[model samples]
Target: MRIAIDAMGGDFGPRVVIPACIDALTRHPHLSLTLVGQQDEISAYIPSAERQQFADRLTVLHADKVIGNTDKPSHALRQRKQTSMHEALCLVADGHAQACVSAGNTGALMALSRFVLKMLPGIDRPAIITAIPSRKGDSYMLDLGANVDCSAEHLLQFAIMGSVMTQAVAGIAEPKVGLLNVGEEEIKGNEQVKLASRLIKEHGGINYAGFIEGDDICAGKVDVVVCDGFVGNIALKSSEGVARLIGRQLRDGFSGSVFRRLLGWLVKPVLQDIASYIDPARRNGASLLGLQGIVVKSHGGADRQCFGYAIDQAVAEVSMDVPNCINRQLEKSIAIKYRLKRSP
Candidate 1:
């Protein structure tokens, strides 16, 4: 399958994206890539031998413009069609590419995706969903800065979409779904969270796991966590901060004394394993769920390896036909609810 890359979008531009693409190509021989950006700049990072090696699998789509980090989503939508990000997404919309991955402006990515791909039939809004590292395993969380303000119905939609994503991408069967609330009790939380819980419990085709508090997120109480974009975004950022803090404290403690340093030396391999497990680079991709097409977003500041992780997600989702799975599951859910409503 062909995957489009916004080569000009990230903090380091093609310097990071090109190497990531090469790494992905090395790992996935079946993958074809279309690097979108100024041809000269992108080609500078790719040596002739490397180009020759992947000639059949790599292509470059020249885009004269780029959407900047500070550009408003609305302005980007109205005036940035010739940009690398926009053209990359267009390739997916036109079916020339199976998926598109970008480390560009998050708001701009979400806006362009909605405009280019449209929403799924039963989905009213698109959500940003990503896998968060958990004790038992990784749990998928949705609405991560996509739609800040959401309704009860929107949260329900996010639950179903997130559930399908976890099942399709994570390969979980009947993935347990939960609402991100302040408390585990059904009576807790505001009107929206409570109503969303009620809807999910009453609906079919979903494994509703009831309310999960913020502390339960990483504990792996559920496979999928649903919340408004405002809450999800904050939770994601806070977790990132805590991860960094823990990493720093561990480093400081390990290097503080000769004895501790000796101990660290003996456990270097184990520490590396633990660090890799918690590193944000290892889990860089966030899915733009509820879109008709597949789009993956990488952190704007992601490095080459981190960006590769994003590409890996896009590749897996494309191979799994995540969008089709979500659409089918949603159709079944709507039918089930309709039948329930019609029943005596």
Candidate 2:
């Protein structure tokens, strides 16, 4: 499968994106890339000799324009159809490529994806599903800043999508789903959470595991966490901040004393492994679910390693055929719901 890269989207633009493509190609020999950006800018990033060696696999599509970070999502697409990111999404929508990856403006990416690729059947809104690392493994979080305010039905749909994703990507046979809430009881949380809980419980197809509070996130109590975009985004950022603080404390504690320093040296490798697993940049990208095509969103500030991981994620998503699985499950759900509604 050919993956399209928005070579001009991120802060570093082609400087980071071009090398990421090379890195991905090095790791996965079967993978091919269609780099979208200004020809001159993209070519400058590739070495003459190396480009010749990978000439058969790499192709560049020139997109002279660019969408800035501050560009309004509503107007940017119409204003800049030739922009690198816009053109990359267009490639996926038009079947020029299997998937598109970008580290540009998150809002614009979602808006453009919805406008271009459109939503899948039975899907009201497209959600951003991010894989958050946990002690057991990686857990999926949904609606991460995609739909700020979601109805109970929307949350239910996110649960369905998240469960399907975790199963396909994380290799779980029947992934457990959790609703992010303030307390673990069935009656806890605000009106939205309560209503969502009712809907989730009534929708028996999903593997609903009841309410999951903030502390349960890292504990890996559930495989997928569903919440409105606002709450999900807040929880994601807060967790990132706490991880950084803990890393800093560990660093200071290790360096402050001779005895501590000796012990730290012995355990430094293990601590570093844990820190690397939880680092935001290592897990910064998200998959845009419910679209007609696959689109992965990376952090705007993502460095080379982060971009590389995002490419790996795109590969895995395509290999698993996540969009097709989601579509089939949604069709089954709608059919079941319709039949239940018509019954006496």
Clashing pairs in 2: none
| Consecutive 10-residue window with the lowest summed lDDT within model 1 | 273-282
Candidate 2 lDDT over 118-139, as tens digits, reads 9999899999989888877888
Q: Give the runs in model 1 whose Cα sits over 4 Å from its true position.
A: none
- What local lDDT does model 1 show for residue 182? 92
Give per-residue lDDT, candidate 1, residue 178: 88
lDDT of 1 by residue, 170-280 (tens): 888899998999998878899988888888888877899899899999998999999999999999999988888888888888997899999989988998888878776
Candidate that scores best on lDDT? 1
Model 2: how far is 222 from its true place, Å? 0.3
lDDT of each: 0.92, 0.90
Estimated TM-score per prediction?
0.98, 0.97
